[model samples]
Target: MLRTVSYHPVVRALAAHGLHTTVDVSRTYPQRRFTDERDRQYAIAAVRALFGDPAGREENGRFHCLHYESRPESR
Candidate 1:
């Protein structure tokens, strides 16, 4: 059996400490498992909510990637 884990809470904690994060989504997982595009989009939305906005994004084959950098210190 395959189990799924969520890292959203950990990502949020990192963001709160001004750490950088990168998220990568793909249509397939190890062992030939697959995921829907809608699910990937939902993940993107969730990450964006925590990290604000991605500093970079890329699409490689069936993979969608996002990079989030620590925000600059406010004046």
Candidate 2:
């Protein structure tokens, strides 16, 4: 399951106090469509809404796991 720390500053700060911060929005378990950009956005937004922005955190930022991509034949 793809996981990461919560985005909320408060939540993240409180994590040391025995709070749960790991979010599991893996497409495989939830049966989500990773192919659709909208779906991917939704998943990311959901994380932000539930937690908060982790961009301010050190060594942390948004990322995507695109194993491969296809280019147009003409290109």
Candidate 3:
């Protein structure tokens, strides 16, 4: 568990809201579509990348989960 007490403004803001844990979207329990789906998808992809999920792939040269690669313009 890497906890570096990030100094980045975004991290600080999220920390203020207790959004510290990685937003997991796994093969066993995929994140569901929500009203704020784009945000969730992006967060899930980021969490996958952070945790080194095997299904994470490169899309337009940027790294994200497989679903984001398939549905590139969801946002």
Candidate 4:
């Protein structure tokens, strides 16, 4: 079963930092939401390079955002 993965704040934050979030980022990693700045930056770069643009929207309330998964990215 798919899990919930809301990475709006992180993706938004990365975009704000001039990092382009991409879609291929979906399940690109073992986990979503990175606490480490370096990891986040790397992930953003990687996803941006592979996916190009990050698409997301708020669902199940303004708090939950669908970053890179239909249901969730697990964890």
Candidate 3 per-residue lDDT, tens place, 1-75, comes to 111112246545656665553433343232333346465456546545555442433212232322211112223
TM-score of each: 0.31, 0.27, 0.24, 0.29
Off by over 4 Å in 1: 1-3, 27-75
- The alpha-carbon deviation from the true structure for residue 3 of candidate 3, after best TM-score superposition, in angstroms, is 9.2
lDDT of 1 by residue, 4-71 (tens): 23455766887788765655443223232126766545544644665533223311112232333445
Tens-digit lDDT string for candidate 4 (11-45):
68766656665554343223345556665555455
Give me candidate 4's TM-score against the actual structure: 0.29
Count of backbone collisions within predicted model 1: 0
Error of 4 at 5 (Å): 17
State residue 62's C-alpha deviation in candidate 2, in Å: 12
Minimal lDDT window, size 10, model 4? 57-66
Instruction: By TM-score, rank the candidates, best first.
Output: 1, 4, 2, 3
- The full ranking of all candidates by lDDT, starting with the best, is 1, 4, 2, 3
Relative to the true structure, candidate 3 reaches a TM of 0.24
lDDT score, candidate 3: 0.37
Q: Is candidate 2 or candidate 3 better by lDDT?
A: 2
Clash count for each candidate, listed in order shown: 0, 3, 0, 0
Which window of 10 residues has the lowest lDDT sum in candidate 2? 66-75
Assess the local accuracy of residue 21 in candidate 4 as a C-alpha lDDT between 0 and 100: 57
Off by over 4 Å in 4: 1-31, 55-75
lDDT of 1: 0.42
